[model samples]
Target: MTESFAAARLPVRLTINPRQRQPPSVDLLAWIHRQPEYRPVVRQAGGGGGRPGFSDAVIIAVLAQGLLPGLFNLLQSWVDQQRTEASIRIQTGDTEVELQVSGRTDSARLLAQATEALRAAREPGPDTARELGAGAAREPGADAVD
Candidate 1:
């Protein structure tokens, strides 16, 4: 008979952005918590409150590696499209950094590459600049006349 083995799973649930339950920030945070270094643990709120919470370290590490970059890119697009405004807010146990995209640029590829690098803490390849140049060439030029 063949034996079937199941992988061990962590027993914890964390909600990153409770207000925007479907936001990408929440997805990124959940993904980040699964990383080997996150080391999350549930804790009771002080004063014996029934609510459970996560370690500040888990929040910080995820913010540093996952949330900030993806947020900057996502928000950049939103702000450039006049869909939202940039706002940075830091609280006692957490920080939020927001950036506004100044001009018309897709920036999808740049954000993807940046998110991947931050997730792995690795440097991007040298050919990234060449690829960026090629992408820029597809846009309409300032001197083009009808």
Candidate 2:
């Protein structure tokens, strides 16, 4: 089942919100596409939507050949570089999990928590929810990101 599941495509949406005070002057979407790892797996979904003072964009990518962890890390790094906020939401059927980070948030810790939560969600068992709770307790940085 895991093998078959791995072969299936996953749709991940990355919503980027540039800094509220000073929006980035660079082409963030183009920059994201230019990244070595992101070029093949991700693409801008549509034109950005938001009012003048609150600029925001969304990128929808089909993950046909990569681990979620790697993608998560790449996004975290990209957002960190831009000094902005982003939310990565992975939707599988009716279940959706999100990892959100602000400019001041710690990326590594939030990434870890989000990764573990997704893992637990995928492999649901008697102890899965408990495991997620335990994982959350262990990561102090988890509270800062969400």
Candidate 3:
């Protein structure tokens, strides 16, 4: 016998009520909350009438003036931000000797990995820029341009 698994994917449609106040109001939230497309999918995802999975599409539609591309742009911005943060760190060392690595942000996992790499190479260095390689590198002396 063999066992197999399938991933369930659903197309979600979301709509916001225009009659509602332009900025914030009940009619908009209600329209989004009562949209038919999400009901079945939420149920399938183990949510009942009381507890439903708020689909990303619904949230996007509500937040971005119903523009899907806007939602994607926002998400992309966040992703780009994380990647930028993950690259920023200061290094103190000689060109051929040892280097010290230091990052302002306290990401434990990232710090630990940097420490491990430093220890393995027996160098005192912060090679964050070098680690990024040429293609990924931002302009020289540029402070993590957004």
Candidate 4:
């Protein structure tokens, strides 16, 4: 119970949007909550009636290092099981990355892209550093699941 070596966690917003006539974010929230690991951390988009929390955003506390592979893995598995199209917008601070996912999603590739973007957010590259200074979120995806 010491703070000295405790890993710092940042709240990252994950917005799950069903691409077609799939299902609502509530259903997805239940699915994610069913996961033993994510059960405790996953929460509703809006809390105490906040202004911008009106969407399908689910917040997950993340460590600056080891970027929650389980969360991505769970997302890919959900996509496979549902056999539907969806998009997950992962955001922290002013940096963001959107990923289109579906049954045919290349899990590994998306994981790589997300990891790279998050790393950049944590330690921005030359270009990303400038973009951050300019207050722009990263746009590396149109990044479809098809």
Ranking under TM-score, best-scoring first?
Answer: 4, 2, 1, 3
Candidate 2 weakest lDDT stretch, 10 residues: 12-21
TM, every model: 0.22, 0.60, 0.19, 0.60
Report the lDDT tens digits of candidate 2 across residue range 34-141. 667677766665677754654655666655423555565566666677777665555553344555566556656755565456555567566566456445634545
Q: Summarize candidate 3's per-residue lDDT along 1-146 as a digit string, tens digits.
A: 22111101112132211211123223222333354543332221122222132221222122211222332233223333333211222221311111111122223333333333323333335564344322222323322222
Q: Which stretches of candidate 1 lie over 4 Å from their true place?
A: 1-64, 68-70, 82-102, 116-146
Task: Write down the TM-score for model 3.
Answer: 0.19
Q: In candidate 4, what residue range of length 10 has the lowest lDDT sum?
A: 133-142
Off by over 4 Å in 3: 1-86, 95-106, 123-146
Q: What residue pairs clash in candidate 2, if any at all?
A: none
Expressed as tens digits, the lDDT of each residue in 12-85 for candidate 4 is 66666544453553466677777776766666555433224233444444434234566767777776776766
Clashes of each: 0, 0, 5, 0
Output the worst ten-in-a-row residue range by lDDT, candidate 3: 3-12
Enumerate residue pairs that collide in model 3.
98-124, 99-124, 99-125, 100-124, 100-125
- Decoy 4 TM-score against native: 0.60
Give the TM-score comparing model 1 with the true structure, all chains together.
0.22
The positional error of residue 13 in candidate 3, measured at the CA in angstroms, is 49
Q: What lDDT score goes with residue 41 in model 1?
A: 34
Q: List the residue pairs that clash in candidate 4.
A: none
